[model samples]
Target: MIELRNVGLKYGDKEILKNVSLTVRDNTIKAILGPSGVGKSTILKLMLGLIKPNKGQVIVDGTDITNMKEASLYSIRRKMGMVFQGNALFDSLTISQNLGFFLRENMKLPEEEIERRVEEQIQFAGLEGYEDQLPESLSGGMRRRVAIGRALIFKPHMILFDEPTAGLDPVSSKKILSLISSLRHNNNLGAVIVTHIIDDVFNVADCVAVLYQGEIIFDDVTEKLHNAQHPFIRSILSDKILEL
Candidate 1:
């Protein structure tokens, strides 16, 4: 589990977030919904210990990692995996190579174990035959699946998705949502999904948090978001503001 308590952050004189609080609990999918430039990605960074909150605490599992040393963050980070928006795959590397990249680079596991883990994730992602294919050869959704498989190589208890279904057709988008739902239900992995699409939230999220002007205007279960009374949240639900 991860929780942010009254967290605040700034870049120069611009305030990115102020007194924002949220939580991602075990066996649940929490979607952070907001428009572009609303600091959605920033929250993910804080959770990963890539950035520190200027004023509050970021608790991961049971540890407050807000002020943890960079060296000490490795252990905490290994428990979580992040699927970047761009997929961020090495185009030159095959699917298997991409999934095993970090294991070979950071982990001292034996070659056989690494191969076993890579194959395991390949099957998990439903990309068995594509293991030898390069990123350029796969479709957009396939690439995203590869990105997710790579993240799962270490079997992290929690996964963070940054716009998981951002640029894809409707069918592709739904497939990604189904995959996320399966990952949560079958694998029992907690997730925090950052997205602007309302459909994405409804499709896979168990809970929702609306971020606007650096503050969360609404936070509750997904079903409640449809009946939200807040002006901004109502606008979002009505599609008056599509992005948030």
Candidate 2:
């Protein structure tokens, strides 16, 4: 499980998060919902220990990682996979190379094992025939799938997604959402999805935490969001999508 205990952060006098607390259990999907520039992505970075909070603690799988050294955090970080908003694929590498790149770079596994893992991810992502293609040639949804496959190649216990469906068409968005739902059922992997789209939250998240003005205004099961009495939550429930 991952827990953030009263976390706070400041960036050159501008506060980003303030006494924010959250918990994400294993084998479930949690969505962090908020408007643009509301520090939703910052929470993901805190969970990964990529940035240090000015106050509070970040616990991942029973380890206090808030003050842990970079070297020590490596193993802890490997337990979770991150998919960036931009789909961060190497344009020069083919799909197979992209999927197997980390394993080959980080592990001393044999060539055969790397190939096996790469093939497995290809099948899992439903991109079997596109294995030899570059990311640029595929559609936006396909590229996202490739990015997700690359993340899953690590076989992490949990995945962190930054705007997973931000730029996709409606059809593509549905496909991505379906794929995310399948992860919990098929792979038993936990996920934390950071998004501004309300429908996305309803489609995939089992629980949600609503961030606003650097504070979490609401945290509970997805269904309870509609009943939340907070004005922000009520506003978002009516707005459906938080572009502002």
Question: Which has the greatest TM-score?
Answer: 2
Worst 10-residue lDDT window, candidate 2: 235-244
**Residue-pair clashes, model 2:** 0
RMSD, every candidate, angstroms: 1.5, 1.0
Candidate 1 clash pair list: none
- The reply for model 1, stretches above 4 Å from the true place, is none
User: Model 2 over residues 20-137: C-alpha lDDT tens digits?
Assistant: 9999999999999999998998999999999999999999999999999998998898899999899999999999999999999887899999999999988888898999999999
State the lDDT of candidate 1 residue by residue for 138-158, as single tens digits.
Answer: 999999999999888888999
Tell me which residue pairs clash in candidate 2: none
Which residue segments of model 2 deviate by more than 4 Å?
Answer: none
